[model samples]
Target: MHILILGAAGMVGAKLLQRLARDGQLGGKTITKATLHDVVEPTAPEGCPFPVEAHASDFARPGEAERLIAGRPDVIFHLAAIVSGEAEADFEKGDRINLDGTRMLFDAIRRIEGYTPRVVFTSSIAVFGAPFPEAIGDEFFTTPLTSYGTQKAIGELLLADYTRRGFMDGVGIRLPTICVRPGRPNKAASGFFSNIIREPLNGQEAVLPVSEDVMHWHASPRSAVGFLIHAATIDGERIGPRRNLTMPGVAVTVAEQIEALRRVAGEGVVARIRREPDPTIQRIVAGWPRRFDAKRAEGLGFKAEAGFEEIIRIHIDDELGGRFVA
Candidate 1:
């Protein structure tokens, strides 16, 4: 099988690439080739059994999506997007890349006479706004409060409609805010969720932009990659016309997250967090969903960490080499 991963240089995308290179297969078929795409060149996984091609280009540019789709890869992982904060800050760039880029890719797939590849779109919890239920469910309607969420919501609709028209086998998974994200933080409004824990474990200070009581849904980087793998291989007929589902994750408050960090890495590490609230970030987080009843996705075999502590441990094992600063 041939695979294509958009946003291949991004955190999750890069991890997914490493995973595939290690496994060297998807859905029981051997991977023969892979094409990586991003605004900047992506680093292909080393020692892969298959040929990995990396391309640096704007897929949203006219004719660009078409050029990338010309390969007709068996599975396409669409992970590219301007994150929440950046999207909210730059409306034009967000709409161009997140919304227009998605549509162009879908249209390009339809133009192919006899191709209907599996398309796994990485949507977000941002798709649901405030006034949410105690736990947002699969049946809840999307009422996005931010430009980034609105853009993702639009992409979800397009994925379902295009799949209904038989243009592609689409699965849109609304991922939780990935916690303990590896490496330097980007512009995501949710970055602080990872930062407060990540930096502390590295013996560095981190800013706490929101109050400790602020609650949100979360998952580890490992689970995020697992969601993509299952979405790519799962039976589309089983997913039905909805075509989109909220992924499973742990729900915890900032206070609980800090407690979990203390449990895993000790009080000294947790002490590195310094609270200096930013109303802008707090307001953005205020409009996001806090928890989810993701039974629908769970039933389909999607899984996540049972608690925030487990999530933190997974990060320590995967990225910290199983140890942290005392």
Candidate 2:
């Protein structure tokens, strides 16, 4: 199978690339070729059995999406986007990259004759806005309050409609805020979720821009990649017409998250978190859904870490060499 991965330079995208390179196959089929695309060139995985190509360009530009889709990959993983905070801050950029880019990709695929590739889109839980039920479910309506969320909501609708028209085989997974994200933080409004845990463990001070009482849904990077792989390979017929589903995740308050960090690491590590509230981030996060039922995704074989503590341990194992500075 030939695979194409957009946004392969980002954290989640990079991890997915590494996982695919290590396995050299998806589901059960050997990968004969792979292409990685991002605005900034992504690094090709080393020592791969098959050829790997990395391209850098603004895919939202006219003709760009068509060029990427010309190879007619069997499986397309679309993880590219302007993240939450960045999107909310720059409306036009968000609209162009998140909304127009996705549409262009779908249209490019449609233009091809007899090409129906499996498309796995990485959406966000941000698509669900506030006034949420105790647990947001698959049946709940999307009422996004942020530009980023709005973009993803539109993308989900497009994916379903395109799939219904038989233009492509699409699976959209709405991922939670992936906690303990490795490496330095980006502009995502949800970055603080990972920051408070990651920075403290590294003996660096992290600023908590929101209250301890604040709650949110979370998963580990490991689970995020697993969700994408399952979405790519699962029987699309079982998914039915509801092509987009929320991936399962753990729900916890900031206090609970700090405690989990303390349990996994130590008090000294926890001490590194200094409270310095930022109203902008607080306002943005306030509108996001804090919990999800995600029954549809769970029944569809999607899974995530059971709780915040396990998420911390996974970060240590995967990114911190299985240990931290106590």
Highest lDDT, which number?
1
* Candidate 1 lDDT, 1-326, residue by residue in tens: 99999999999999999999999999999999999999999998778889988999989999999889888899999999998878988999999999999999999999998799999999998888889989898899989888989999999999999999999999999999888899996556788999999999998999999999998999999999999999999999998999999999999999999999888888899999999999999987887889999988999999999999999999999998999888
At residue 237, give the lDDT of candidate 2.
99
Query: In candidate 1, what residue range of length 10 has the lowest lDDT sum?
Result: 183-192
lDDT of 2 at 1: 93
Worst 10-residue stretch by lDDT in candidate 2?
183-192
Angstrom error at residue 19, model 1: 0.3
Model 2 Cα lDDT, one tens digit per residue, 188-288: 77888999999988889999999999999999999999999999999999999999999999999999999999988989999999999999999878887
Candidate 1 deviant stretches above 4 angstroms: none
Error of 2 at 140 (Å): 0.7
lDDT of 1: 0.93
